[model samples]
Target chain A: MTLAPFEGADALVRRNNISSQGPEGAPAIVFGHGYGSSRQMWRLVAPQFVDDHRVVLFDHVGSGGSDRRAYDRGKYDSLHGYADDLLEICHALGLSEIVYVGHSVGAMIGCLAAIAEPTLFDSLVLVGGSARYINDEGYVGGFEADDVDALLDSLDANYLAWASTMAPVFMGNSDRPELTAELLDSFSKADQAVARQFARVTFLSDLRSDLSSVSTPTLVVQSTNDIVAPVVAGEFLRDSIPGSRLEVLEAEGHYVHVSDPEKLTTTIRSFLG
Target chain B: MNPGVQARDLFDLIPCGLISATTRGVITTVNDTFLAMVEKKREEVVGHHLIEHLTPGSRLYFETGFMPQLKAHGRASEVAFDLCLSSGETLSVFLNAVVDRERDGGTILFAVFDATLRRHYERELLAARRLAERSETRVTILQTATTAFGNAGSEEEVAHALADASRAATDAMAASVYLCDPSGGFSAPSSSGAAKQLVEAALLDALGGRGDPSPTGGLAQSPTTVVYSGSAELSAHFPSAAAALRTARVEALATVPLIDDGALGGILLASFGRPRRLDPPTVDLLESLAQQSVLVLQRIRLRELISYRSLHDPLTGLPNRHSLQRRLDQLLTGTHPNQPTIAVLFIDLDGFKSVNDRFGHLAGDSVLRRIGASLERAVRSGDMVGRLGGDEFLLICEDADEQSAGDLAERLRATVRNTPLEEATGLSVSASVGVSIYRPGTSPEKPTGDALIQLADEAMYQSKRTGKDRATIIRA
Candidate 1:
């Protein structure tokens, strides 16, 4: 059956490049992507929810198909700015009782939005999330201040490579050239300046104080051997947020949604029920 | 040439390091050049994550930035990283990699170039470019500040313009100008941005004299600009100020003293919210701003002094007769609803001629100066008191009628009587006071300032004829 992505899209939907599908008048499930990735990262997992819920996916500003001009450095200096954009998108679409599934930085964006408006979200699924990336006195955040600075340097060093990576990779599979092209196109559209600043904001931001205020039911999904967000970070998220549970996936790597989509989808489905 | 044999030889003998690794970055194979560059054995290199051989920063970049791009696009090129060698040194390397994909994962081939010379050159170029940009910003700030100061009519406006210009030049979170008072201490600062608390805390630290050594150090030894970058650096110099900054989440401070011609004109303070090591160029910009502001402030003060001398009595420092006439004309020209009547009180000292003859002209000048000060104190805030040459003084008041003006005239007569001639023993002074009242929209004819003064002089003669130490009132 044919699934119309933007059947009844509005201004916000067009601006954020939102793609929606599912039965009408169904409970909505929105997916937010993390740093270094966009809405395309949700490709393997989001479709599983379409049978029962209205699945919505959109790119954050300066990433994917979202309008790059909307990226204001002052406004997006903190994650709250991204939360404001998310709330605006949700309000424009008239979506409430939302099941928000966010990964990495997007997870904190969801948490912030949920804290600002508790009644709008029914639940939150945080994958590979950390409140703070830098290790404090007692916290094991898996990184240091110097590491974050190095990450910014890395961004500068890779600017040329990232800009030129738009060329499509057609090794052996020539039949599915369009799919590969679309993926690369969205990945290449991410503004380099925005990505650099976003990295700084994401790594330097400390949301430990804001976590205890979250009232929505949450599911912290973590992966084994995840370098960015370790198991301790997942446990911290679960303990800090009220009524939240932690689930450790048997997968390896930070991107659990991409590494093991079936397991991630099953866990999300179980949690929603 | 045999193709397979030539390719094998070329791979081992290549100048750059080459490696094959798993998608997860675990090295599976490495050429001879790669082993020689890292100064490691083949076994030590293989079966370890490629990130282990890289510096912390490059490792982070590879995983978080480069790896993701490589995974999505199947290739990445010209990515720079620093590889840690076994000899306790780093190799600045640029990599070009391609992934051979499988159903679930992939193997990757990486070509690494030693870019030590290139990286060094690039850093030099970047620093030069940044210096050029900062120089341009400094010039623009000075130009804008010069224009603003040239147009500034008052000291407060100059202070504001300097504050704004300094903040823009330094990219500070907040900037302020603390003017020097006559007592040689700084006055309350005129600020250009928010975070007044941060400025206040920093100002206290600056004025506390921790930075200045040898209390009597004159202009030559005075510190030009004192910059503290982080909490530790700030705490080392000013502990309490650092504590205050910690509470405000401020991390950097630069204090530039505005000095001109061996006198402390004022001070400029710039603060930052993030930990920042302000380079030498930024410090230079602060000093330049401070110098420009000092020159502008000097100009403003000089102009103010000249204007003050022109319209004021040199002996008593009271407004001269010319200034009084101009003020009276201005008051009479305006028309408004419920306008108050303007009253002019003219007074002539009764016994001043005898005191001048007895105690010399210096004593007479001292008595005039004392009376000028007393009259200035006696008048209302909006009233103007002026000396109209030799034993004559004028007082202008708004919102006064005939009865109130007569009362004020009597008070002035008493003030003159109570004047103690210190140099001449047993000598005292009194005044014959006259008042003229003018009501707007009520009088038959409007009188000019000279005519009004003449009428008051006639009334003063009437007071003198009747009795000394008395007042007379007349409506003009």
Candidate 2:
């Protein structure tokens, strides 16, 4: 059956309500989007998984389908707040043995939630993950503090232009120009200040110590030629976490899941099995 | 070819180079600039092979790829290759091959452009950029260090600030500041790293057993003597120092004296894990920090002395009237708001007038002092006992309701009645005890120190009216 266009999650579900999709007996899978994007990021991937799994998608408090009124700045300022929301959703749905698939900042939230309440999920798939974005005493991730600062300034100057420029690089689809417009729309939908704060929290936060605390089985998927989230960052994540398997896809860039869906799906399926 | 063309016009005419090559690799057409660059003349040899005039390396490269690629492809555009001239110098050149489709494709046109100057300019720009970045980092470190020192207002603040500055300045794994206590002994007061263990070790050694001998001598003796020791004991205990010296890494260490009035208050020891030379400018900064720390220590000491004087009596070292009253009010009124009731006792000495007449006022004063001592011993630590004025004292008992107050008052009366005041002063002395029970919500005005004292005093007068050395209960 074809699904209708989702009404904004922030409007449809009350702050306290839990929303679910797909059949009850199906294998449970939760989809979490990154900073600027919403649950709509999973539009292509969710449908493919739904035939076998109960696909669960919800917006973070301040973003696309969640209750904007319930967004508390102090609580939503860090990854811990998103983790709290994820845990709340798990409790509300009585979901167990679930598989969590997260992208970018969403990957960090999934890791945090898994650490906080390990029994909530059985496995985690982190795409384009980095424990610490900034280089420190021991580790060296390319891009200094100023480089990140420059990126933030670029984002602030003209978010739509920045999104358009980055979308082509992220998806690695220079042939298709429409993807850039889609990304620009997603970025423009959220409040600029809120998105800025979210970006700062996502890119600047150091989570090296947090990776060691995660007990659930994890899969680290990295695109071979991703410039935004480099291969070295993926290697760092793989090395930091215990028992985390790393799968390096020959896919072009950061948004490999969208660009090369068949390869991504095959890898995830094999890992999950 | 255009033989009448002017040298400047022909040489600088196009952005690309111009040349002619024969089937046997002889340069038949050479411009005035190309002839000057190769240091050749037109009459000297138009028949000589171009490979023979060029350097051995260039001859090999031209024969191997350039000639073959041009011959096969008909034209090659923007081929970057190195050219070695007769002067033994190599130049990076962008070579473009031109072939006239009408000319049987036998003769090839070679155009060469000089790129050495551009490449050199780019290299210099990159080097300058790296230098600018390093200079900017140094300035940032200096600014952060200055701000840190300026914000340090107390010994703890200075220690914490120094630790933060060292970490930022050197980018070390950890930084710490150890301070000396009053006894000329140093300990890690504020620190980072496994600071607790290091603090305990330093404290143990300074206290005398022997492990890591004090890095800074007791600054408590003389502030100037508490210099940065660079001692073996320091390197042995502090991992930062060892890391600095072993790796030749830049780790900063600064020791500032916590001085007060030329006497050493303590020493502030700051250390990082990289090898940092104590430069003249850095030493000067540290010295200024030490002086400022002295001022801070003095201000803190003055504040402490003032607070002590306000809370205790100048004469007997007991709490003064102001502090005693504050304590009494807190007990009687229940400052906690959740507690229920409280009690107050007022005692006035009796028959002291006759002692002042017969034995003299000195003996009566002695009797009062003895009573004060006895009263102090009778009360619990939580209870507040204070001299309200001459021959009159007040006691406040906490968490005591009306019934408990009556029992305590009777016990106090009997104890005073049984005391042998006549033996000590050669005059009989007794106390009139009055008890006041606090009633909550009766007086819309909360009970003040004066109000509670007045109630207890009135009850004491009633005790005196009936008989001295007796107790009377007054309910508010």
Each candidate's chain B TM-score? 0.84, 0.53
lDDT tens readout by residue for model 2, B1-476: 56666655766466555677654345666665555555567654465555554433333234322453344346666554445565767665656666654554345567877767854664476458546755675567556755765665556776676555544443333445555565545555665432334433443344232122355433333344222223244455454435333232112344455555655555544443222235564555555555655565566557778987888655434566788788876665555446566678998878867766787767766666667777777777777777766777788887677787777777666655556676354566778989887766655567776777789889999999998888888876
Badly placed stretches (over 4 Å) of model 2 are: A1-18, A68-77, A135-140, A159-190, B1-346, B353-389, B392-409, B417-428, B433-467, B471-476
- Tens digits of per-residue lDDT, candidate 1, B400-472, equal 8888888888788877777666766788788998888888877656788888888888888998999878888
List model 1's recovered fraction of native interface contacts, to 2 decimals.
0.36
Q: Tell me which residue pairs clash in candidate 2.
A: A9-A65, A10-A65, A10-A66, B184-B218, B249-B275, B250-B274, B250-B275, B251-B274, B251-B275, B251-B276
**What lDDT would each prediction earn against the true structure?**
0.80, 0.62
Q: Which candidate wins on TM-score?
A: 1
Per lDDT, the best of the predicted structures is 1
Report the lDDT of model 2 for residue B463.
Answer: 95
